[model samples]
Target: ISRQKRTHKIILPCFIGGRSVSRAKSIVNKDGCYFDFPNDAIRILDAMTRSSRDERIVIGKPVLRKIPVGTKIQLPYHIVERNLHSVSIPIIKSNFIAPRQSTPKGLRFPLAAKAVVRSVVHKRSSGAVILDIASRGQLNDTLRRFSHMFARKLEGVYVQPMAKPGTELILGYVHDALMGDVYIAGIGGSFTEDVHDIGFYVGKPDLRGAKAMLAQLRHTSIITSIDVPFVAHQIVRLSRLIHRHPEIIELDLNPFIAYRRGGIAVDARIVTMQT
Candidate 1:
């Protein structure tokens, strides 16, 4: 037999002429019996013939690779992680404030806290989520309880502050394989899926596209009334979000509340093709 070993710098000969090569190879281990072709037949024969205690060996492929396995992975969770690391958006950081903390200034609400990081959008058969808190103590307790319900850590929870309708809008960007990046403007919130009112345009859009979308909406009258503030400025901010990140694939600003002058994405989800 011809082989190389560390004992000798070069190839060395073992059992010069007496050793006979076999076609099959086998090894006995504690686990189970293992055998494979294109292997060392001599080793297989030796192990079989040698006297040993009853033991099991695994018989399988010539070689098996080991991989460090973890818990099962979810697609949506993975997408969220990717977006968290790669996508750039002008949204509030959920971790900045402690759980059950009040929303910062300029984003305050009457009944509910503004800029809550909602779990999912569109109230499906599962129903909508509500985190009611009469006082700060209840808020902290609810925040802690919600932490255990989800798969991952609860960075931010939903805030249901009082908000006037027609102020909130949807802003999004999708990567078109053909057209490159496309921006979408539409009225969103609970009625997003139900209403399905929106406008689509390609590339970085100007104020024109934003106005066009707002004008076409059924609730265009609310923006004109001027009773509340932050109606027009919110649209401009939404427009800027689109212009800032051209690589965004899909985004959701569902039920963004427009209060006085500026708007806040009370609930939003963003997807990025760049990841």
Candidate 2:
């Protein structure tokens, strides 16, 4: 169909014989030649078609693939934090106490009694599964058991002191085929899925832009009570990180606890093109 007439329809450009062409014609548009093919044959064409601007373009509907599991191993917390800093998000201060299997008897009791410790096993996209250690007596056993249970499916275990209670917020960026990189932020943590409250913006946002987006959330009151300017600055930094790192496809800072004094990322997950 002519470009003027086809403006309203979804236009999928196809490159044939080193030249671009429009293969399919609208049924209602009599100006272009239409071909009637069997349903099975049309399905084949649909499977092969790929779109430049459509993010969902694939040979067929995607399906889940099974991944092999392995034993969980602990990584140093400082190393983890250092690596995450490359992404421009603030990492919570933590320590890798001990592997679940080899917890020292003398250390476990003292670590749990005084400090509010949290055991976490990190995953690429799933973030970390956190378990709070109430008493020193339960630390060793709990870590060992939890490690064995999720070892095969997750990366490794690490322990850190829990952050102070504060307003939790989700900050992220996703690359869209048409829109490029998009920034997302909203109420996070346990309420992330339930609330589904979020705001989206195209490209990188400045401090003012970030604050404006934050102001759009339903729980703006909570966010405003804390350091709004600090959060906005972090959002802008995250956007810059996305722009600089094209390999990063998705990045999430969940439960980004915001206090009146400052903010800390309780948990973070990043998915790169290589992963």
TM-score of each: 0.47, 0.59
Write one digit per residue (lDDT tens) for candidate 2, span 108-192: 3223211112233223223334355656557656566555655643333455556768988888888787998889888888788
| Candidate 1 error regions (>4 Å) | 1-128, 144-166, 225-244, 259-262
lDDT of each: 0.42, 0.54
Q: What's the CA error at residue 143 for candidate 1, in Å? A: 3.4
TM-score, structure 2 vs. true: 0.59
* Candidate 1 residue-wise lDDT, 79-163, digit = tens: 2322333333223323223344453333332334322223443433223244333555554555565555542434444444544
